[model samples]
Structures are given as structure tokens and as C-alpha cells.
Target: MTDKKMNFEVSKYDSEIAYLSFPAHPGKGKKGIVMKQKELSSLIEGYKGPEVYLDFDENGELIGMEILL
Candidate 1:
């Protein structure tokens, strides 16, 4: 298992919902995920800050984070 981090942009967001995406994809359209504030905060360990990317492991565990302002 390996940890991975990818760059993403804040495509759309509101008080409760956020959409993240990469500008380019290999025929997969846009690579992105839609998450609620509750779920995102949990992955970020309750730290409310400007986050530009996400970190997860092969087992799909949220293990690390990066704050790209």
C-alpha cells in the first residue's frame, strides 16, 4: 500500500458541499469528488483551513494532508 497526493482545484463549493477537480484527465473527463463539509473535515482531522489537495492510502485511509494556499 502507498500513500498518494494529487493536485486539485476548487471547482465549486458552498457552505455544505464542495467539488474538487483536476484540470486534465486522460479521457476520463474530470477527475474529481464531491464531498460534504462534515466528511471533508473528518478527513482533515477537524482542521478548518484552505486545503488544495487530498491524501489517502491504498486502503482508502485518510492519512496525510497539505495546505496549499
Candidate 2:
């Protein structure tokens, strides 16, 4: 991954969801974290909890995560 800054943003509606974005590789759409920019290639359940999901890019690099709140 490029050495770009990452950003975080939460939903305005009662903070139901949050987004972590990689500005270096911006994508299109909004389904979750990765979906907020890049297209989701695959999603893996986070070991920490069921509400956490790890998002990956087409190359299999971790782009961001989504946590249900």
C-alpha cells in the first residue's frame, strides 16, 4: 500500500456505522469501510467480534474495516 494518510468518519445518523478510508487508493461506493471508496473484493469476519469486518482490495491488501455500533 502507498504511504498515504488514513481517515475516519462516522455516520451522522445516531452513529450507526463508521468508515476508515485510505486516501491513497480512493474507490467508488459506500457499503462499508472499503465500500466507502474502493470496490469490495472480499470480506473477512474479524476475530475480535462478529460486528467487525475486515475489508480487502482486489490485490488482497487490507483497505479498511467496518464496525457495527
Candidate 3:
């Protein structure tokens, strides 16, 4: 493996929602831009936090994350 750095964008809206987006893979055209609470259980085992959500592309690569603040 080669040493590489990945760039991400973080945005907070109205001090309510914090979004972390991956610039390289936008995850557009995916079923759901943000995974639902029910979906989170299967993806992240033992994670019981309701404030975090994730976005994945068709290829199952994590592309974004949404956190409620």
C-alpha cells in the first residue's frame, strides 16, 4: 500500500446538523444519501448512538457522515 491522504469536507448547519462529506466519491444516485437509524444497526454493530448517520455508495464505500448536534 502507498501512503495517501484523503480530503473531506465538514459542514455544520444552524448548529443542529454536522455533515462530513467525502469529496472524491459523492455517493450520488445511491438509494439513500443518509442511512436511516434502522439501517445503522446492521452497518455498525454495537453502535447505539442516535446522533450519527452514514452514507455509502453503490460499491459499499463510506462516502459521508451526518451527525446531529
Candidate 4:
């Protein structure tokens, strides 16, 4: 399921998408970027939150995002 989870643009290779928890600064939003699907899981590893989420388009563009907490 392509749920809502903030991701980042680390790198890419083939069908793998390297994503991270929308790298956010102190009291600020995250630096979102387009990422592949394969990278999504590893990026979200070892994180605590109310819930995980993501926002993107079929064309691989960051449209919107959110965090359960």
C-alpha cells in the first residue's frame, strides 16, 4: 500500500528508490525529493512516530506530505 510517508532524494538505481524521513530541520518542514519505491522502506527504517506517511505523484513529484504526529 502506497501510504503517506515523507521521503527524501538520496539516490537511485534501477527500480530502487532511496528515500528518507523527509529530512526536516528544527521547527521547519522537510527537504522533500523524488525517490524510487525500493528505497522507501530502508529510508523509513528505525524511526518513531505516530504513523508513517508519504505524498507523491505517478510522475514522481512531491505533491504533498504529512506526519501522523
lDDT tens digits, residue span 1-69, model 2: 666788787877758788675654365465443433322233443434426556676566677766676
lDDT of 4 by residue, 41-62 (tens): 3467775544434555455654
| TM-score list, all predictions | 0.27, 0.55, 0.48, 0.33
Off by over 4 Å in 4: 1-42
Residue 21's lDDT in candidate 2: 58
**Most accurate candidate by TM-score:** 2
In model 4, what is the error at residue 54, expressed in angstroms? 1.3
Q: What is the C-alpha lDDT of each candidate?
A: 0.39, 0.58, 0.56, 0.41
lDDT of 4 at 32: 38
Q: Give the Å shift of residue 16 in candidate 3.
A: 1.3
Candidate 3, residues 1-69: lDDT per residue as tens digits?
A: 424334444453356666566663444355655433324656677867656766666566677666664
Checking candidate 4 for backbone clashes, the offending pairs are 4-53, 4-54, 5-53, 5-54, 17-36, 17-39
Q: What is the lDDT for 34 in model 3? A: 45
Give the CA lDDT, 0 to 100, for residue 56 in model 3.
Answer: 67
Model 2, position 45: C-alpha lDDT score: 36
Runs with alpha carbons beyond 4 Å of true place in candidate 3: 1-13, 27-50
Candidate 2: segments with Cα more than 4 A from true spot: 1-3, 27-50
lDDT tens digits by residue: candidate 1, 1-69: 324334443324444333343222222242332222233455566677655344444445443333444
